[model samples]
Target: MTPTDPFPRVFIGFDPREDVAVNVLTDSMQRHASAPVQIAQIRLSQLRSVYTRPHNPLQSTEFSFSRFLVPWLCGYEGWALFIDADMLCLGDLAELWALRDDRYAVQVVKHQHDCESGTKFQGMPQTPYRRKNWSSVMLFNCGRCKALTPQVVNTASGLELHQFQWLEDGEIGELPPQWNVLVGVQDVPEDARILHYTLGGPWFDDCQTMPRSELWTQARQALNHPLALQASS
Candidate 1:
């Protein structure tokens, strides 16, 4: 936690060269978080001895590993939650953090869509290769999971990450579905809080999906609060 109360510092990865994604994330942080949201933007470095691979196949993020490593570099020694920019938070967030337990360095819950429909990853049946929960979001314990980072980095470098073939081991628990609701408009319930654009983004100026837009609105409420954006110093 930064000296500003108990709120964990939040970080996002971006290249200022691309302003739109950075702007989208910056706007979301202020709109959603209960406390001050700290945003960090990292540029690829020429520094030597960088972690080049991933330990867990699931965590091989093209741009996210470096972002995930920032807190550690700053001497932070607690757990950190990493979310996709497309994710929007609804309801109180403390519950997710409180769900952390001793055995797992992370907590994940089965995906609701896959869990209920019996349809599996990519809308297929569950098999040995596919995880019920496709990683839209994740939480990590710096103290407990730090050892896994080097391995994650290694696997990242070992393979062609551009294809996004890596994912973390499934042993970690799933985050509740409430934290990762997708853009299911017209058919979804009224209280759904998050709207993950798992398949398509509403960013297109010509987007015409109302249900998806409603979902985006909900996400913006949590992630794009106008007040929160103005509060950033």
Candidate 2:
């Protein structure tokens, strides 16, 4: 079936205290938008392990939400687009929404970053998914994702919620770039629909080239609200 047949809904993971993320996600759901978007705050407990505790400082809080992606989407009715806060839905999502199929859990390919840090992330490998991990902006089949989350999250070394790189460590099917594209990192073929805030992000990861991003605009607007997170959170 084509994406136009029955558009897929968009779903993004939201950590609490991120009103800016919430605002942008809700705003992206405009009727003129390409498709529907849903936000799910991850809820889970932590399991202690070696790769999780001794080495990874952010371990306790990181992987807890990592494995929840598939489970969260599975709870939904059909196909969905999963992206981080660093993206904006510029074009109609109807095309992406239609990628869900029973055969495989679709996602974009992971390209290695040019920077030393990105390349360095490539060095430490343990999970089955790290072999060719793609960017976080994934368009996937919720049903497929559900079937695979257990295997992905329950690896021998377990999951590592790393902060610096493209891709989550999971065995997901490949979706076309039209579904999820990274602007700065990925070549961003002219026909590509979405723009991933790759190098610099909206909230201030690496602000070298991230200027006038749609997310930044939404972030500014969110801070104007009565209960908003400040710059120094």
Candidate 3:
């Protein structure tokens, strides 16, 4: 948590199909966040009017444009964090939250990841693109992201946002890759802060065993455990 605020606002991309996955990620974050956490879902249906540009459905997922709406949703005020719902938090988010730098428009795990190959969850084709996983976990310097207004997010070309063409190189700051450990694409470090099931997770029948799948499986197991529920109550 920041010194001035007791509750941090976090927004996660939401897709109806991934409700359970989102819940696990939320539970993991709340368990570790030091202060009370406020989590909001970014839904495309609600953001449609905000986008003023054409979008290509073939190349998009449920979360494709939602991530870009963080600053707008916050009314371009104080800082806010946006993370994909597929993530599993392993460390206190306050740590990630504290890394915010006001100089840049956004701070992300600057992964030089090649676009993912092979099939994605439920057989979604994995297409490669620049700045591949960079937007998965972000600390939006909302005040600096003024250009990413509702109209821009609604209509900007996918490449402009995903490739980060929206901002100059200096405007982007790098975060430790551990904050977004890509399960299959990269090696998991001893102190990974978050585990991202970029491809798929155990919840899907086809992805019951991706790299670090055990972590997610264990998280779900903990969520389902009666003892865990009793403890929370």
Candidate 4:
């Protein structure tokens, strides 16, 4: 399919607290994507039937486990991408879209980050779990991820999905690290494709000085978010 084809879908998590971050990320994607991208923000609060049930012990201030529902959300069709809300796209997503491999159930940047020292935004413990932050960005081969049904996402332990316990490690594929570059932990090359603000984001007052914060500010300005514009001033 063409990069501009309406086939490859993208799903991003949304939290009310980071509302502006989500908007800026979306704007960046739309601006650089070659095709008419189909994007959806997975809002936990709006998913009554799904979120109301107790899923797992894993904690998150944002969409949390809702990300695992991507394959099911897309009706298990073709490939779909899922990214955290606190991310900025600097390159055409179509490049990543073009890398979809039918051989694996899912593909992600294989991160070996050891972020045990810091806490997530608002003081949530940054517990270092297995395959940590790997799922922060993913390309789900929906047809291949048949195990991720609505029931599975609703009941599976956080470890089960995040660690990819369902499939053999061999079933997972790797993408270029540039596709999910962590803000401070990684050396972001001049041509990094995607910048992930894993620690926190400029939306939080203290994160204004973090790596790539300036880029995020520019993206926000491009989107014309009033609060971010005023904050930048």
**lDDT by residue for model 2 (1-233), tens:** 54442655554544343445445644554433644444553333323331132334322223333533553436633565556544555556665555555565556545554433331111232232342235356565555444334434444233342221223334455666644455555665666555555443454433535544654475447545586767985
Best-matching candidate per TM-score: 4
Model 1, position 127: C-alpha lDDT score? 23
17, model 2: CA deviation in Å? 6.9
The C-alpha lDDT values of all candidates are 0.48, 0.47, 0.82, 0.84
> What are the per-residue Cα lDDT tens digits for candidate 3 across 73-99?
888888888998888999888788778
lDDT score for residue 145 of model 4: 88
Error of 3 at 198 (Å): 0.6
lDDT of 4: 0.84
lDDT of 4 at 196: 93
Error of 2 at 6 (Å): 4.4
RMSD of each: 8.2, 8.4, 3.7, 4.6
- Clash pairs (backbone) in predicted model 2: 8-97, 34-92, 34-93, 107-175, 110-134, 134-167
Comparison by lDDT, 2 against 4, better one: 4
| Runs in model 2 lying further than 4 Å from the true structure | 1-7, 16-18, 29-39, 43-55, 58-68, 72-77, 109-114, 118-135, 146-172, 186-190, 205-208, 211-233
Question: Clash totals for all models, in order?
Answer: 31, 6, 5, 1
Please provide the root mean square deviation of candidate 1 (C-alpha atoms, Å): 8.2
